[model samples]
Target: MTTGKEYVTAVFEKVKAQNSHEAEFLQAVEEVFDSLIPVFDKYPEYIEENILERLVEPERVLSFRVPWVDDRGQVQVNRGYRVQFSSAIGPYKGGLRFHPSVNQSIIKFLGFEQIFKNSLTGLPIGGGKGGSNFDPKGKSDNEVMRFTQSFMTELQKYIGPDIDVPAGDIGVGGREIGYLFGQYKRLNGYKNGVLTGKGLTYGGSLARTEATGYGAVYFAEQMLKARGEGFAGKTAVVSGSGNVAIYATEKLHALGAKVIAVSDSSGYVYDKEGINLETLKQLKEVERARIVKYTEHHPNAVFTPAGGDSIWTIKADLAFPCATQNELNAADAKALVANGVIAVTEGANMPSTLEAIEIFLEAGVSFGPAKAANAGGVAVSALEMAQNSQRTPWTFEEVDSKLYQIMKAIYTNSAAAAKEFGEEGNLVLGANIAGFLKVAQAMSAQGVV
Candidate 1:
């Protein structure tokens, strides 16, 4: 019988051997494997088929060139990638990101993470991710529209409602989604469910924008409840001013927690009295100004451009890493713990490094892994798919209530799986084992495809 650590070690060595540049990927895989020891022991067949090895590698990787003319009428080319990591449980489903950091390695890591996240949500969507190195920040409306249309020209061939569906992520938010969906419709003539995160008039679900952040809080709420505490009266430090970070701050505030700081790639803003939501919305949504400008209105607040590390020194009861993968490291985790942080939840995929996760676990801080915590976004994406298939729309109240129920169920199922494997109170193990079992069983049922 192979010990779980031994199996994990072997898999890590194999992945490293395949691609030495995948250090970040290997590290993320190791964290999940370390948490899966008890599950491996319980389900010995996972060892027989070498599931860990298969899980780390994606099933398909698509790379293509996106060529578009800028306002100068000059043709500039960008590389795009899509990694359909797994379809064990259902069709391929995940978001399409548009950030300069996108690459095959990053997309592979994200898609691999998505497989478990989608499973944890108990949704019948598989795992996949697509994105380009296109930066939409400074591009004019026409430039962005043309680029998006060119991107979908090739992407539409690979995605469909019953095959692979894509939504929005990071730089690919509502505006980007609208462009991508419009291009898809132009190419394929309006297939309703081929994409999610659409404009509500085009079959998008309500409460989708708030799902991830709200879900993170809901999952954190569960973790707190287990420890005889809750979100009421806690102080939180959330990093990022994007959709995820903004909505997370909103939900935290709504739950009676004081969100003192919110950041952007430009910098972070600190308001001891808690951030003003309307000001933040104007900064992020309307003006698209840097977060540093936030301090102009509130002279008492501090702005730090270094983001995660910039605000780590501030004290808070909870920390939500909502920016990007591995944004919070060992030092940051130690800072939060030292400052009396009782809980940490990931609003971004693999936002916490292995060392940071270990630090939190050792400190007895309640941690909610990304798979269970950020599954809300994809859960609501699945909801959108349901609405599209039914040819109907749900009221905001109905959708919000369903989203809450889904989040609670995801938390309960992940927690129960953790306890069942004798790793009670360790959500890392629970989320991995629970998500793995679902995908593994689906793989078995599908018979080696």
Candidate 2:
């Protein structure tokens, strides 16, 4: 009686009305929903079962107050959230993002995206995301430890090895995870499987730090291969200086692509001779300094402060957006397209806007969606969980090899789904359909929960 497009429109309209304030979540939903029309049209059963409606709604949402004392003995209060989105596949698995920009909508968006991203990995993990609005930047080790301990004191009750496994994201990294794990162990004993991204001295997986960035580059390499090309001698512009961007640059360099620029919250630094990897690691990972300091080490490079146009202005053969959501906008997309960007692979969740994505598609630039491109991080996180469960650690080469294979598989799966859907080479549609189909089938088999 109703067309698939109509069904999608109706469901999305209802979601928008119910979550009027969740702009980021709504955008993510709309993007995924747009890709499902072909799927729903071919299989009317999905509409009859109202699978889209169920998928959009999280299974559980926990909101709590997190109060901790600052170094000044002043008390600080922050909002914490956990959105357990889906569990049809396996235990709820996702990352914990801690940043000043974190909010309900952002967490929900990340969680919703995670559902499919996890499914795409061919792993049994489901989707969920938790985080706090506390900024870890500019905080001392003591201050960070206090905040993570207090935050975990409450979060520990809701998470476990086989329950919900949370990894690091944004502001949450090795230091934060260590502190959180210490608190968890203090409360529930040594449960290494309760969290991923732990230190190697504990239960951390080898190559986990490099998985996301390497995976993205690996996926992008596949995209280029699909076009009868490779990353050799290509110029690259990567956004963000965090774990994702840093590792992505490393991989790009290894793959024979010259990563000419990298960015952070302060803005981006451009080096015509290609970024110095060790210097970047010292400034970001070790010293935890802003990107502006990059020029101090490489005075030959130029540092552009934030607040003008974002990182897309850098002309390059490839563009990797490894920063926060919507960091690449319409103007940035236009600039990249104008600059002849051969491929755009996402290393962050929804880094590109809908308009930007459309522009890329229309321009015939090969695009790797975030769910498939950045899934390497979570894939390695899942491996960490497996190692923790088995009480064994894998070597870095072993982990890196597994990561490469998984990333290649993701690209093949996404591309196959796109070709099957008659939208050949449209990875956005392919990734959404491929991931949704997996989760939707699992949900269907289990029946209404």
Which candidate has the highest TM-score of all?
2
The candidate maximizing lDDT is 2
Q: What is candidate 1's lDDT per residue for 1-449, written digit by digit as tens?
A: 78776777788788888978866566666777777777667777877787777777788889999999999899989998888889788889999989998887788788888999999888899999999999998998889998999999999889999989999998998888999999998889989899999998888999999889888998898999999988888999998888888889999899999999988777788999999999999989999999999999999998877734567778999999899988888888888989999999999989898889889989999999998999989999999999999998998789878888888888888889888878788898888888888988877666655
Report clash pairs, candidate 1: 267-305
Model 1: how far is 88 from its true place, Å? Answer: 0.8
Candidate 2 regions off by >4 Å? none
RMSD of each: 1.5, 0.9
Please write out the lDDT profile of model 2 over residues 275-348, one tens digit for every residue.
99999999988888888898888889998899866678888999999988998999999999999998999999
Cα displacement (angstroms), candidate 2, residue 228, comes to: 0.9
